[model samples]
Target: MIEGPYFVLVVLGALWCGVAAGVFVAFSTLVMRGLGALPAARGIAAMNSINVAAMTPAFMVVFMGAALLCAVIAVVTFVLWPEPGTVELLVGCVLYLAGSFGVTVVANIPRNDALAKLAGDEDSERSAAYWRRYLSEWTLWNHVRGGAALAASAAFVLSLT
Candidate 1:
């Protein structure tokens, strides 16, 4: 049961990601809907900043930790998974790490980079343009995040196996 302390990490990482997935789905959806109503970059910028600030710490921890943890889980599973629904849980874990987390780090982070450049001081065309473009593109990624998270959540359920 202890050859792989990694599985413990994997389960920890999975639960961590699972929580993040839930938060991402809800928050990103709000950002998406916010796009239609927020005509200013300031509003969008505020939302983005707050969200990033709130998310960065946990995301950094889990993103760095997941691979090591999951790999251990894979090894442990290969040797000693309980054999009921282990496969489902493992696959679900893979999907979240591969799909949802991938989208957040790859797709969303870059957009946040772009968004961070926009200034919120007074009315400005560049800011508006940035907000408009940012909202549209960001929302697409948000949907992807939400979908992937839902899939991951389903995978988390497999832990019962």
Candidate 2:
């Protein structure tokens, strides 16, 4: 059975993944929907505000810390090959690193960066068009990341058992 600092890390990783999953799920299920219901300009403005708020130290520590932990776990898992829960631990690492963290870097952040460039003027056709597409695309990616984090958390829990 896994023990010592390694075991503690895994437990923490599981909790972190669960927290990340909950945040993503909130955006996918409720936050985005509520924002989308607003006028296009208002929705864009609100999302921009949310995006800025998300960068605060509290959220970043959890989100980025989870990614860092996953990377460390993956490397350690490789070095300590054939240990108990190896497969499950590796699965959790990959799910969070690639599916959640990687997707955020590749898919969501770019879109957010683009959205940030917009003036969010109510009369601007360009902003309105982008906002419509952003609502659907961003939320779709959010759903994927949320599922991945939840699955990672489950995998980590399985490793403990």
Candidate with top TM-score is 2
What is the per-residue lDDT of model 1 for residues 1-161, given as tens digits with 9 covering 90 to 100? 32245445545756765665666677666756765586675576676667567567666665545444555556666666766556765786676666666777898888787666654552688777777777778778877766665665566455543
Query: How much is the lDDT of residue 46 in candidate 1?
Result: 74
Listed per model in order, the count of residue pairs whose N, CA or C atoms clash below 3 Å is 0, 0
Q: lDDT per prediction?
A: 0.64, 0.92
Judged by whole-model lDDT over C-alpha atoms, candidate 1 comes out at 0.64
Residue 135 shift from truth in candidate 2, angstroms: 0.5
> For model 2, where is the 10-residue window of minimal lDDT?
118-127
Off by over 4 Å in 2: 120-122
Please give the lDDT score at residue 20 for candidate 1: 57
